[model samples]
Target chain A: MTIYYSEDHEWISVDGNVGTVGITNYAQNALGDIVFVEVPEVGDDFAKGDEVAVVESVKAASEIYSPVGGKITETNGELEDNAALVNSSPDGDGWFFKINISDSGELEGLMDADGYKTFIAGLE
Target chain B: MGAVNNDLLKTPLYSLHEELDGKMVPFAGYLMPVQYPLGVMGEHNHTREKAGLFDVSHMGQVVIKGNNADKWLETLVPGNIIDLKPNRIRYSMFTSEDGGILDDLMITKRENDIFMVVNAACKEQDIAHMRSNLPDHLELAELNNRALVALQGPMAAEVLARFASGADEMDFMSYAEVEICGATCLISRSGYTGEDGHEISIPAQKAIEVCKALLSEQEVEAIGLGARDSLRLEAGLCLYGHDITEDTTPVESALIWSIGKRRREEGGFPGAQIILEQISNGTITRKRVGIIPSGRVPAREGTEILDSADNVIGVITSGGFGPTFGGPVAMGYVDIKNSENGTDVFLKVRKNKLEAKVSATPFVPQRYYRKQK
Candidate 1:
């Protein structure tokens, strides 16, 4: 699986045609404590950069944009009762949804893991 | 997005905050920490359960002295400053000439002078307002060389008593000068958080030492502005610019109790005519009320309030998830007719209409340290 990141701090891990999407660890840390997560419904369609989800922290609410155009196949239901999972394991169990990639070419526009690290460093 | 601008002022505790990995943000022209590694929720819960140390040096501290100081102050605010006994603190606000709130502040009657703590954002303007209004005989001395810190929670008294003698014996709203960690500090048994706490005003040079000594106590952990905001909201307190502004009147803001009975009867302070008229006639158009949203969706500031008929009635001033209350709570102004307790209201959050009710506050019971007789 190859991980791609957006400048907006969202991350997606791709395997075959399906991609698992979640906020990056850096993003979760910046957001502080997660209080609520609003996930998109299964079978919802989205284009790249469309606001597909919301993550509310103790401070403020942030929108999560779709990294690539796709149809949502599944959502992490555990976040309904346990939003802290996003802060605890943002890259793993805290995944927001699974999307069926509409176009593989869209992933090329995103930064790779190393490139994302350098980008985040520049932010500091 | 890059490092905080160097031009922003830093409090004496700036190095300590960086050492603790505090998330620095620019607020009110100061580079201050909004949260720590534990995050806002964790820091908030820690303060509720144990004790939280807050760096509140950004707030303005001033001393008003000279003969007839209290009498002169009484003309500016609606509260009874002249009758306030020595060493006692009273919550009051500076009222505009037209019956609007200029700024809310805490005034303490010290031995020979009055000490005031004003909001950080309004300090400069407040000083100018007071200076321009007061006679030359009355002196206003801004204490720029002091730093304020708050130790708050159920364990606050116990933790504070370790260093400052006589702290455990102080009652709510009372203050005393004491030696803490070898620095002479003015400690007050009052805080914005509803929890039992003490706000210590220490010398700017000794602020870091005093804070370090307090943090050494196991019960005390450094909290940030994030938890401070949530804690005050849960306590149903008014934030300066949001909950109470120049556009809001004290009567409409539900702060009528802060006005002294004598001040309420005789007209002396600014806006006395209008405030007293509203008091006797009960003709306040809008009134502040607490609200509890029905679901986990937190209603934020600027959310519109609607009545049963779906007509707009009010707008939320402050709203968020209360860590201590374990739910979403808010406070806002509604039409006087719909401001009664238990009045059903709807909040327009985004595109959906959420169910809510006007409820009484402080959502959690206030735990002030009143000396038991």
Candidate 2:
């Protein structure tokens, strides 16, 4: 599996033609407590940079954008009842959705592990 | 006058907040901690179960002293300030000439003077309003050297009692001067969290020392503004800017309970005519009511409220997730006819119309301490 990160703090772990999407640790930390999460529907088609989900904290609501164009194959239904999973495990069980990649070339635009670390460092 | 510079002001506990890993954010032109390492949810739950300390120095505290100070101040608000006994506090508001609220404040009658705490954003204008209308004999002194902190939650009184003797005996809405950590402090047995707690005002120089002492207790944790906002919202308290603004009248905001019967009958304060008529004739067009969204989605501020037929009935003023309530909670101004409790409403968030209900406030029950008769 290859992992890529977006500037908006979303992480996609690609395996074959499917990629699992979720927010990064830094993004979840910045968002604080996760009270509500509106995940995308299965079979929904989205283009790159489309607002796919929304994460509401106690203080504010933040949008989650799609990093690459794809059709959502599955969504983490557990998030409907336990949104705090995004805060506890942003990169693992907290995965928001699984999308079938429409074009493999879009991965070139995202950052790798080292590059994302450097990008977050610049933010601080 | 607008602040030309971009620099944000810091409270006396700025350094302490940073030391505690508080996420600093800009609020009311001041750098304040939005949340600490525990996060807003943790901090909120901790505050409800135990004690939480907060740095509220950004609020404006002032002293008004003179003969007939209470009567003089009563002219600005709709509360019965003249009847307020020494050390008793009354929640009041400054109303405009047209029956709109200018600012909400806490007025405490001390032995020789009246101590008032106003919202930080409205302090300058509130002070200016009081100064221009002063009777010459009355003096308003803004306290810049004081830092206010609130110790709130179920265990707050027990934690504070270790420092200030007899603090637990003070009745809710009572104020007193007490010595804690070698500093003379003004303590109020009241809080915004709907919990039994105290709001302490200490010298700015002694703020750090006093806060450190309060935090040293096992049950106490340093809470931030984020949790404070949620806590107050859960408690059904109104935020000055969002819930009650200069354009919102006290009658429309469901704060008529704070007005005394004498003030309602005599009609002496600003906007008294309009306000009194609204009280007698039930002429308010909009009413503030608690909204509970049925779904997990939160209907944030500015979200539109719709009736069953999709007609826009009102707008949400304050909306967020209430950790204590374990669900989405909100307060908004709805058409008076649709403001009944259990009336079904709809919240327009993004493209979705979530189901919501108009309900009574304080999603969580308030636990105020009242002295046994």
Candidate 3:
């Protein structure tokens, strides 16, 4: 429940270096209906802004950017089988993957829960 | 020139789509519904198992009225048009004199007018073609602003029967003038999903009333372009830009059924010589077969189909994971010999040769109602 946010609309909470990440509800609503989820393999390292995943809705394919420099520790295997979960619970059970953050200091630049809420609200 | 002002193309049911949280996309210059919150696969499966409604307002509606309308139109298209009964629809194609398909269209005979529907993107060209080719006595009235909707799936007729009284009386390919929700419009018993459904053409202002009346039924749900694509694919129907084009002749695309018996023997429309010759002598090559990828990965358009020896034989036209079929399906051209029912083939997918097989079309069986009478 240690909600940390990325400018890319992804968020995570860390238990030591191991953390869970998923897109905000705003991203899911904007994407409109998750049809397919393309996830990177476990142990794949990614830098911020690197395309780590692909989510396809009905008409378009959206790229999910890495929220922080991290090594993939685990992925939501359930999404591979049931992509619709991302649409139903984007923030909770639909968390895309678990990444082990390579640097905890990166959190200093990320948005807090209150700041992300304000940022999202301003978008409308 | 219209200057591509898309704001004018909104349908009467636009607000309803927004209410259902439909994702909009720009198609044929109109802000259109591509999918609802359920996405393409879900909507497609729902249509197969239940029912779906579509806003097809982009299609062109035209009326050809004159003493010689039928006789004149017969010269342009390759259907038995002059023989169509007053209320029946006949599927036909406008041919270039050299035998290329200019465009495919549907024609209906009214008391004093011959009404027509053409693809949304090609309407301007179609009207222009008809105007120049048709003599001065024949008048072409383009109803470009009308809105059309297609109620599809097995339960479609049941839903439409509530508002359009006496809807069940019509059979497949039949249409008539019907009053729906206190509005007069043309309702046709034809659709692109290869199912027993109806295509309703109404004035732009009255379209929403019809949509509301149909949506009132618990069995009806609004569908978008995403599901529309998959449903048509599952039905083995062709999309204009993907499955067909002007450069591709009708013979090679396996559209011989559209060519009538008399036209085949008499040879009057465009490209009659080449078309008739190919019919008997066999097309130099034919578009045939379907492909199902082994994995969940979908082979999109332009993906190469190869033989065991790695020979690029054909190109994939339309490919995606079908909701009803429960797997990825693709349609493409293949050599006639390898186009048999169960031939093994391979598709090149992102550095991997995925196992695929040539299978017959309509991966999901169509559920359309038909009446003998």
TM-score of chain B of 2: 0.98
Which lDDT tens digits does candidate 1 get at residues A22-56?
Answer: 99999998888888888999999999999999888
lDDT of 3 at B348: 88
What does candidate 2's lDDT look like per residue over A26-122, in tens digits? Answer: 9999998998889888999999999999999898999999999999999999999999999989999889999999998999999999999999999
Error of 2 at B55 (Å): 0.4
Give candidate 2 regions above 4 Å deviation. B1-6
In model 1, what lDDT does residue B162 have?
Answer: 86
Best by DockQ: 2
Which candidate ranks first by lDDT, i.e. highest?
Answer: 2
Report the TM-score of candidate 2, chain A only.
0.99
| Runs in model 3 lying further than 4 Å from the true structure | A58-60, A100-110, B1-8, B16-21, B37-42, B97-99, B286-288, B335-337
Per-residue error (Å), model 1, residue B308 = 4.0
For B1-373, candidate 2 gives per-residue lDDT tens digits of 1353258889999899989999888888888899999989999999999999999999999999999999989889999999999999999999999999989999999999999999999999999999987698998999999999999999999899999989999999999899999999999999899899999999999999999999999999999999999999999999998999888889999999999999888878889999898899999999999999998899999999999999999999999999999899999999999999999999999989999999999999999999997
Per-candidate RMSD, Å: 1.5, 1.8, 3.2
Ranking by TM-score: 2, 1, 3
